[model samples]
Target: MVSLLKNRVNIASGTPSRIKKLIDIEALVLSRLAVILLDIHPDVKGYSLFTLPQVRDEFWDLYKNYFHQRLLEGDLRICLYGPLPSGNEFKGKKST
Candidate 1:
C-alpha cells in the first residue's frame, strides 16, 4: 500500500517540503490522540478526558494540567482518557 504522499512530497500539487513536514508531524500527533480517545464514549468530537467516573469536564482539567506538567518535566506527553469508574481519581487528584 502506498500513500499519495509519494516519497514525502505530493506527486501532483508538489506541496512544499516544509508544509509536508508540518502535516506529517501533525498527523502523528492526531493519530496518537485518536488512540487515547478510543477509551472515550466514542461520541466526543475532540475530547476524551475524565478523572472522576465519567466526569468529562473534570477529566480534561486534570489531563491538561498533567499534560503541561509532563511537558515542563521534559517527559513524553500524552493524556490518558477513559470512561471507567477508575477515572474518578488518579493519584488523589480530582477535578477542580
Candidate 2:
C-alpha cells in the first residue's frame, strides 16, 4: 500500500530568528494605544513588547508607573458599566 500524501514536513523542527527593531518607547506606546482604541486584531494582551535590554529601563519607567495606571482606569470603566449587586443579594450568605 502506498500513501498519496506529498511533502509531509515537520514544521516544529525549524527554529525562528530574532529580529529586534530599536523603536522609541513613547512611539511604541502610542502606536499600541491607537491599535487598541481602533479595535484591531491581536490586542494589547496578545503581545509581549518589552523584552530587549536596551529598552528595559525606559519601558519600566513609562509602563509600570504611567501606562499601567491608564490600563487600570480603563478596566474600572468597563467593570462599572453593568448593573452592580446590592447588599441585599448577600443577606442570607454566611462568611466561610
Candidate 3:
C-alpha cells in the first residue's frame, strides 16, 4: 500500500502534521494481520479477505477521532478506497 500512503502523504502535505498517525496505524494493523494469517494458515488463501472491513472501520474511527470533525466527501472517499479488497461489507458476518 505504498502507493496509497504516498498519495495520502502528498495530499496531507500542506496540513500541519508531517506524519499521518491514522494511516500508519491502519497500515500496521493490516500488516500484522496479514503476517499472522499467513504464518498460521499457510495453506489458507483469502484470509486477508476477512479483515478488510475491520481495517476500514478502524481507519474511519481514527480519522473521525483524530480530526474531530467530519471529513469532506472527497477525503472520505479517498480513505475508503485506499484500503484493499474494496467493498468489505462486514455487516451480519459472524465473529469467532
Candidate 4:
C-alpha cells in the first residue's frame, strides 16, 4: 500500500495540472485505501486519507523542498522516474 501510494504521488508530482484536472481518480484511490486501512486498523488515524486538496498541497510542498535542495546544490536536471516533474533545462550541456 505504501508503495502504491508512493507511485501515485510520484506520478502526480510530474504533471500537477493533469493531476489536478483529474483529481477524482486520486480521490477515489485514496478514499478506497483509507476505507480498507480503517477497516483493518480502527485505531489508525484517517489523516493518511487526506482529501484531494490536502494531497495536492502537501505534494507541492514536498516537491518544492526537494527542488530547492537540488537547485542549491547546482544539480542541473532532476529525473524522477514517475509523476515528479523534470528539472529546468541547463543550457549547453547534456543531462546524461
lDDT: the better of candidates 3 and 4: 4
Off by over 4 Å in 1: 1-38, 41-54, 79-96
Put down candidate 1 lDDT per residue, 1-96, tens digits, no spaces: 377445443221111233235445664332222212224443435323343244455345434643445555555344435555544345566535
For candidate 2, give the lDDT: 0.32
Predicted candidate 4 versus true structure: per-residue lDDT over 9-92, tens digit per residue = 322322344434445455423222211111111113422212234444655654364344554556524343222222332244
Better-scoring candidate (lDDT), 2 or 3? 3
lDDT of 2 by residue, 59-78 (tens): 44544544566576663111
For model 2, what is the error of residue 46's alpha carbon versus the real structure, in angstroms, after optimal superposition?
19
Give the root-mean-square deviation of each candidate in angstroms: 14.1, 17.3, 11.9, 17.3
List clash counts for every candidate, in order.
5, 0, 0, 4
Give the top-scoring candidate (lDDT): 1
Q: What TM-score fits each model?
A: 0.25, 0.26, 0.27, 0.22
Residue 49, model 4: lDDT of 14
* lDDT: worst 10-residue window of model 2: 11-20
Off by over 4 Å in 2: 1-49, 75-96
Q: What is the C-alpha local distance difference test score of candidate 1?
A: 0.39
Clashing pairs in 1: 50-59, 51-59, 51-87, 52-88, 53-88
The window of 10 residues in a row where model 4 has the poorest summed lDDT is: 34-43
Q: How displaced is residue 53 in candidate 2, in Å?
A: 1.0
CA lDDT of each candidate? 0.39, 0.32, 0.35, 0.36
